[model samples]
Target chain A: MSSTTVDDRSTTVTPPKTRGAGRLKDGRQRSPVAMVVMLLLVLLWITPTLGLLVTSFRTRDAAATSGWWEALWAGGWTTTNYSRVIEQADLGTAFLNGILVAVPATIIPIMFAAFAAYAFTFMDFKGKDVLFIVIVAVMVVPIQAAFQPLLDVLGPRGLGISGQYLAVWLLHTGFGMPLCIYILRNYMSSLPFSIVESARIDGCSNFQIFWKLIAPMSMPAIAAFATLQFLWVWNDLLIAKLFLTNDNTTVIVKLQQLLGTQGQGAELLTAGAFISIVLPMIVFFVLQNFLVRGMTSGAVKG
Target chain B: MTYSHSTPPVGGETAVDESDPRVDDASPEATVPSDYGLQPVKLLIGVLGVAATLWVMMNLFLAFAYHPEWFFDSKILMGTLGLVVGVGGAAVLFWFINVAIEALPRKLEHGLVPYAFLIPGFSLMALTLFYPTIQSIHYSFANRDSTEYVGLQNYRELFSEGAFWSAVLNNVLWIAIVPAVTVALGVVVAVLADKLSASSEKWAKSFIFMPMAISFVAASAIWLTTIYAYQPPGAAQTGALNAIVQQFGGTPQSWLSIDTARLNSLLLMVILVWLQTGFAMVLLSSAIKGVPEDTIEAARIDGASEWQIFWQVIIPQILGTIITVFITVVILVLKVFDIVYVLTNGRDNTNVIANMFFNEMFARGQAGRATAIVVILLIAVIPILIFQVKQFREQEATR
Candidate 1:
């Protein structure tokens, strides 16, 4: 939304120069204490995930007998846990279902919101301001408000789409629309309107202007929302749990199921946890820049 | 002012006047601008055509949505069919509506076309969010299955339950602690990371931010097995905290079961803090980076220490970002369910309102009370909603 300001702000960041004896030209000392504290905090943050990652490779006996650190020091690791978790937990199907649910859920809303955003940004319509405000206000409404009723609406007696992937897809698209429209509209508004004006002057219709002019220009914001939505849907458990039955459960749900109540099958859980997180972790690192931009621009997810 | 295209503007004079220089010889349809007498009929026909197309689209969509078992019994096939019909069909709908709006009388087309683009998204919102939200509130007043009206009985029952109050208190603790602590640590990480060499900063931030990508269920699993795991006094401790405790000649304690004074609840809050601190850092880091370097330079020239400059100079500049990050996290915390759901499922008095709602509705089948909890949650969020609208207006002002 604040794309221009973000660009301006980022460009103004001071380029790093080599620090000799921890001093910068700006009179701010680069303290070694800060670096050490930063490193320690970083270690503290990453250790939990690292421990599980290590344990995921260890055998059940070794994991029960020793800490993950011991396995790290020794050379007792195997790929068996992953394979067993996949086979026993049926995480393979869940992983596929995660993809099946996430892709359309991401694209459908973005497409619809992009068109709506174009109208909100470039066209004059009655009640546009009020409608835009309503969309923004929807950003804060907890999805819980729509939870039970959406179930009723989509259940067999209503639309008969419950337990199917279409149910969650529709729910995700609906829940995602506000932020999508908000982000894309903010971005489209920031775009230079002269191009749109010229296209309109050349007798281009609103549809033509949206497709030929605004859509290409809004790619950065679109990509940002797309990445954010995909991740949110993939990591989501609440909506998926409430909507999809066991037959179409996503990976996150399967991981929870595999954990069991008393934390039975800890071996499988340690491995299954890694399996569930791997795709999202990959997506996060690969799209880290877009993720940051999307977050800063008010892509809040719960 | 121009009609160089095919169709004539409805209920208007001939579009291509010989006196006008914009007359087109390029397209043959432009020569038929003499059809002005029947323009209203064309407009009627266009509207009816678009309406019928919309009806057919809805029927087709409902057919696909309602009967997946009929579509060869594979969700993949039904999903593909639904996606095509849903997305592709909407595109076609918008095209048809815009085409119909082209024959909208005179300047009405100008005003109507935007609505054509807006119909699908708003319709979806109306169905999925707005209507259901009202239905939820209505069901709060109704009986369990929403079959009969029961007034405020659900509210009274929920307010009287100790478990509900415990959930409320735990939620209060979470709201009071998580957002503030996450933002504080985030600012600290952002400032500390900013001082390092660029490569070191990237690696450090990556470690801190890495938790954000994983699901809360996975996060809970990571912590439950790695950090919160416990064993008997003599058995070797596998969990990190227990192992460290045993190394100090102390008994290994079950961290999550220590609910005395809500310690376990506080421990569960740690997982959310760990997961969310990275989000806060990324936002605040950019805010920190956005602060003009010369301001810090000027603060230093005035003999202020780095701490003083950070407090007096940098904090003021990034206050907007801090508030933004703070409110966002607060909203997230208000809806906190997964960590609690996966870790303890509200056992040992760790219940939050969201988990309470989940158990009440799905686990216990108390739809009335569940909707009541949601209504209460909605009430709690109303203030934040108003504040956010104000905040958004301020941001829009700056824009």
Candidate 2:
């Protein structure tokens, strides 16, 4: 309901008004002062990342001798940083490990949450509202509270699955499910009741209706959760570093190790930072619309 | 269709007419008679089948995990098998349960299907989150090894320790500064970017949002190397901040180590702010955009200045978003760990609760004290969780 309300408000007000009449200011009186301030702030916002990207491409001597902006014109570029970090620092293995962790971690929770969300949305069960509310409340519980016992359970004395990818995957799934279900249920309940009523009247089983109708209809929310989950798992450091083996960890953990231990590997560190960010960057840009939709759908009401 | 024909209506009012048999009608009153107790038997078989399959699925994965030598030769094989057993196994388990549920009578099937969908997810939460959370609180009452009960000793020791209080102080400082600054900056950027031409607005927002994609570790490394890198007072400073400071004839200080007035902690908070501002901006910007045009126009007609219109008109409308973004960031700040861990390693008196918990548990092997630290975090979070749930309920109620 809020999603549709937001869309209605934006559609009515956004395009025609923003063209010449500033929403905050009077008609067509464009403030050069505002423009200047925005430019300066945008520059400040982008400088650190831009500088790092430049440094990642420059030769070590060139990077040390001059600032990234200066090195831009001076022209000392190389790919050895990327090549060496991948080969010698074993970021290649870490890259593979990141995928290994992120893919399953993202998929498993989405699968489970999709089913739960469907039940919460369509099925008439006792305590359904209370159960949904509890799950929503669990979203704020910090992951730190579970770490010690989870470590014990997954460690050598219990499941003996610590230092394995399974450990991090399970931790991520458990932590990620509440938010996934929350977002998906919010999106699903907003759909019209007629479609589901019609499908049920035709004698479709709950699973048939869910798998064929609801799941397919919920792609935007699913994409949003998938992107968010993939980014979280890939970028995660504490969980991966704790649960994964040293030789087999995600790229972010590898980058942190390179940063901490080898201060001299500035080139490697810069390149590795970019290497770690590349996938999430791609996901963010490609699913940028869904990401924004997902974020606001849960937070902002009409 | 045939099953719907076997309806035995309870109470004559629910009886179906023999003249018009709409077999496809799926109303609740159309209950089928039990074929001499076979329906309950079928339900029993379905329940056992689901339970047994789920049990087998867990043991199968655990069995594979016990022997790494089976696929240890190839990392690819190991990872693929992990996905298969973990993800593929879940898919198979859910499918098996669905089929089993379908075998039951219609009434039993309807009642059980929701549980079939809910059991896997809630069971995961029960195991991973609920059980562990309770265990953590239980361990807080135990000794260092968590093997012996020590009552409130862990709490007493943690309260008495200066390091624990310092971590709490630093956490409070973080909570005080990060969310407020982030929301303020986000609002400014959102409003300003919204004023720009459409294309430039996209580029400007993207630049601000780009940092959100970078991991905290990478962002911290970037900040440490590019923005905060220090050279002793001079000699061609490499860091942007130090370089600018030298340009203004100031000394190049070790920015991260400066604890005088907790400047180092403030510096680490900047990294989180940098990473999260985009999130605040995107959400707030949309909320601002959603503010109706008539309100601003009316304010202007009433001779309100631009600033007045912004505060009195736009701000109140988007207050919901501001609170949402603020609380979201507050939760993140409360759990702040990776940046502090990667940057200072909690050195220079910059420790927070999460990092302190990590050291107490893994680095020092004091499980009781570590869980006590987590209990403190949980206590701090409870009020916020209650407020958030209440807010969500209000929203749903309005819907």
Candidate 3:
């Protein structure tokens, strides 16, 4: 009814809105001022990233000799740093390991959270309210506290769960579940009840309703949570360093070692940083549209 | 702009017949079997799960007792058992809860479903999060190696130590500086980006948002290599900042090493501001978009100056979002480790609470002091955490 009402209202206002042309004239007059302000803001915002990019491409010699902006006219660009980075550092292996760790780390939490969120939003059970509150409240517990205990559990002597991918995966899932469920539950709870009821009337079981109806409908939220988790895991250095051993170490941990204890090896650092940054950039670019749509869809009911 | 896709017919019209046999025509009632078989099935699954858990436990005990060498030799057997039992038990419990919810009456079912979904996550959180938090507080009162209970000694030492005081002061400086600068820069960018036309706006926002995807460690490495990186004067500088100084015939300086009182620490703060700017930009950008159009129009109609309108009308409307972003940044600043740890390793007066905690705990093996530092951090963070939770709830309610 609201959708139809909005459509009808917009249709009636169209011809009159064309006749009210003063707004366009006023907007056009302000355009130049707006453009200048925007350019300045863009310049300010991009300065650091531009500096990093320029420095990454420059020769270590050139980079050490001048600011990145000086390279604009100097024409001293070289791919030698990249070559040295690739040759000297095991970036290829690190990149593969990062993907290995990040993909499952992202997917597992999302899968678990979605099921949990659907149950939280749509189902009724005893102690449901208290349980949901407890989960949400867990967001306050700084993750660092869990590091030692989880390490003990994953270590050689305690739980004796050493040198295993599943240890890290399960820990990541446990850590990620709280925020993921909080966000996804909030989103799923706001979905129209009529649709769910109709699905039930159509003899859809709860799992079928979740799989065929809720999952597809909640894609935007899913994508948002997945993107956030992917980035968090991809960028994570501490967890990987602590839980994963030498061979299974993620890109960030490898980069930390490559940078070395005293922070030498700038060439390797730059290349390693770039290698790590590329996937998240691609993910962001691909999912950019869904991001804004997802945020509003979940956070705003209307 | 519109292309090939057909719009669905409107006015609540039924486009398909219900009698079509291709589709399942069973009503909700018909779908439910009269035999009530689900309960028995659920009971069977639960029993199987418990039995399997018991079997694994028995095998583990036998291995530990009789075949100790075999147990010691086989890593895969131990890991596999742990996985099957842990993951399997969880899955079974989840399924049982689902079945129970399905068995409930409609009104009760609706209320219970969401909690069922939340239980697994909550259980995990309770174990990993809440348990350790309580444990940390307990450890704080113990001796250096946690071998003896030295009640209040750690806390007393924490309050008395000069480095601890310096850390407190530095954290205060971080809390004061990082959030204010980040929020201000973010608001300015968000406001300016909002004024642009659609095409240019996305590009500008993307540039601002790009840094956000970078891991703190990677960003720190990049900054260390390019910006704050300094090489000695004679060695042919490899850092970007030093290179620029060399080109200008100025002596190269280690920007991170500068102990110009607190300026080196300030440089570390700059890196945080750079990393967080993107986070602030995205949230503030959305908040700017959410500003009621009529308010801006009214301000303009009143002949308010552009600056006045921005500072007065726009700022007031988005103050809540601003505080939300600010508080989030504050919490992040409190937990900041990668930058300080990587860049300076808490050397040259850059030590904060988190780095101190890590250094004391793992490096020095002073678990009591480390736990004390963590408890301090937890105490400091509690108010901000409360505020954040409250803000999130309020925002949710408004939505």
The number of the candidate with the highest lDDT is 1
Q: What DockQ does candidate 2 have relative to the true complex?
A: 0.46
True contacts kept of 1: 0.66
Instruction: List the global CA lDDT of all models.
Output: 0.83, 0.82, 0.69
RMSD in Å for candidate 3, one decimal?
A: 8.7
Order the candidates by lDDT, highest first — what do you get? 1, 2, 3
Error of 3 at A222 (Å): 0.9
In terms of TM-score, which candidate is stronger, 1 or 2? 1
lDDT of 3 by residue, B30-77 (tens): 233321222444445645654565466445533432453675744345
Quote each prediction's TM-score: 0.91, 0.90, 0.81
Candidate 2 chain B has its poorest 10 consecutive residues by lDDT at B1-10
Local accuracy of candidate 1 as per-residue lDDT tens digits, B338-358: 999988889999999999999
Clashing pairs in 2: none
Query: Which regions of candidate 2 are displaced past 4 Å?
Result: A1-29, A73-76, A299-302, B1-52, B84-88
Q: What is the DockQ score of candidate 1, to 2 decimals?
A: 0.51
Over 4 Å off in model 3, which ranges? A1-28, A31-34, A57-60, A70-80, A125-127, A201-204, A261-264, A291-302, B1-38, B46-116, B144-147, B231-252, B392-399
**Model 3 residue B266 lDDT?**
93
